[model samples]
Target: MRDVAVISFSQLLVDKAEANDAELVMPVVREALGRAGLQKQDIGFTCSGSSDFLTGMPFSFVGALDAVGPWPPIEESHVEMDGAWALYEAWVRLQHGDIDTALVYAFGRSTLGPIEDILALQLDPYYEAPMWPDATSLAALQARALLDSGRLSDSDKKKATAEPPKIVDGAAAVVLASGDRARKLCSRPAFISGIDHRIESHLLGVRDLSHSVSTEIAAKHAGCFEKSPTFAELHAPYSAQELILCDALKLDKQVTINPSGGAQNNNAVMVAGLIRIGEAATRVSNREADCALAHASSGPCLQQNLICMLEARA
Candidate 1:
């Protein structure tokens, strides 16, 4: 596989975005490209992540494409999932050796609708959706299970409870390039050493709510535990979820967690996961950490997890 690195990253998070999805996305896209010293045409491929459910309209992502200026007709794709998955697709595309550079982005406006009720629709339509359990309640079930498992200390539970949840509006973008192309775009690139993603059983009843088996599997596959990370950017929307991820990833006390204040402090639906990756990449590029582990999750209570390990060139 060819060496790929994240050369540039940019994000915008706020209580609410006054602009539309396209308007909110354009600035971050421009900033990411500008930082990489590239333009729209310079990007060989573009991938985005967003959800039509949040927009309460079909093909909402299509409107956001205008922000990227498909005019010259750039190759592009969109994922209904988070932007971290879009980044994953871009990484795979770059591996084909045809494209040296790609642009990945995600955006979300939680204020568009009743976000909790919308997320409830993601559950099993027959078994769970009929019950209409909101996202927070679903997550609380997992948290209660974890607390009952005796995996976390009382202090951990208390700490988690103390942090209030903050869901914001945001957009994030990242520029990726391979080998020589990556080296040319930035003085320091956060080279992707390993990356993997895994998912748990969709039925919450069948899975172990206390532990993230999927996260552990992905982290193992991504070589996250081969060496302790200086820090981790975990896409944990709740404090309790952070504890669960830390345990699953086997991070030590020495590792700093959530230097960006995490999703609990500034959760932005689909955008938060991509921001985790961008935050970790920035740390690597800035030489704040020789190596970092970034994580993203989708579904209720960490049902799907993606882990990425990044290292700065020696």
Candidate 2:
């Protein structure tokens, strides 16, 4: 694989975005490109992540393309998932050896509707969706199972209860480049040394709620266990999920988790996971740490997880 690196990252998080998605994406996209010393034309590929369900508009991601200036026309794509997954696609595109750089972004406003209610629709229609259990309640079930398993002490449970995830409306963008192009874009690049994503069985009843086998498998594939990370930006919307992820990744107390305050401080539905990756990349770019792990999850109770291992070029 050709070396790919996150050259620049930018994000905006607020209680509510007063403008439309296109308006919201423009600033972050511009800022990210500027930070990397690149113009829109300099980007070889562009990909975005957003959900039509959030806006209740079909092809909502299409409108956001205006912010990227498709004037001269650019090779681009979109994912119905988070921006982190878009970055994953961009990384793969760079490996084709035809593209030297790519732009990735995500924008959404969960405040437009009942975020939890919308999330419930993703559950199994026959078994789980009919019950209409919101995200927190489903996560609570996972927490109860974890507690019952005797995996967490009473103190851990209390700690988990204290830090509930904060929901916000926002957008984020990242610039990626291959090898020499990456070094030219930024003095310090957060090279994507390893990246892998995995998903568990969709049925909640069949999976082990107490352990995140999918996360473990992804982490192993991403070389997360090969070298210690100085920090980790985990997209755990709930403290219980954070606890679960920490245990799955086997992070030690010495590793500072969520220095950017994680999703607990500010989370924007489709944008939060990408922000986790951007946050970790920013740290690596700033030389705050040599190695870091950024995680993004989708589906209720962390059914899908992606592990990104980033490191400074040696």
Estimate candidate 2's alpha-carbon lDDT, on a 0 to 1 scale: 0.91
Per-model TM-score, in order, reads 0.98, 0.98
**Candidate 1 colliding pairs:** none
Worst 10 residues of 1 by lDDT: 157-166
- What local distance difference test score does each model get? 0.91, 0.91
**Candidate 2 segments exceeding 4 Å error:** 162-164
Q: Tell me how far the alpha carbon of residue 45 in candidate 1 is from the true structure, in angstroms, after superposition.
A: 1.0
Tell me the TM-score of model 2: 0.98
Q: Considering only N, C-alpha and C atoms within 3 Å, which residue pairs clash in candidate 2? A: none
Question: How high is the lDDT of residue 18 in model 2?
Answer: 96
Q: After superposition, how far is residue 151 of candidate 1 from its true place, in Å?
A: 2.0
lDDT of 1 by residue, 141-197 (tens): 887888888767768877544243687889999999999999989999999988999
lDDT of 2 by residue, 1-314 (tens): 78999999999998988989999999999999999999999999999999999998999999999999898888999999999999999999999998899999999998899888889999888887888898888888888887777878778877554234677899999999999989987999999999999999989999999899999999999999997899999998888888999999999999999999988778799999999999999999899999999999999889999999999986
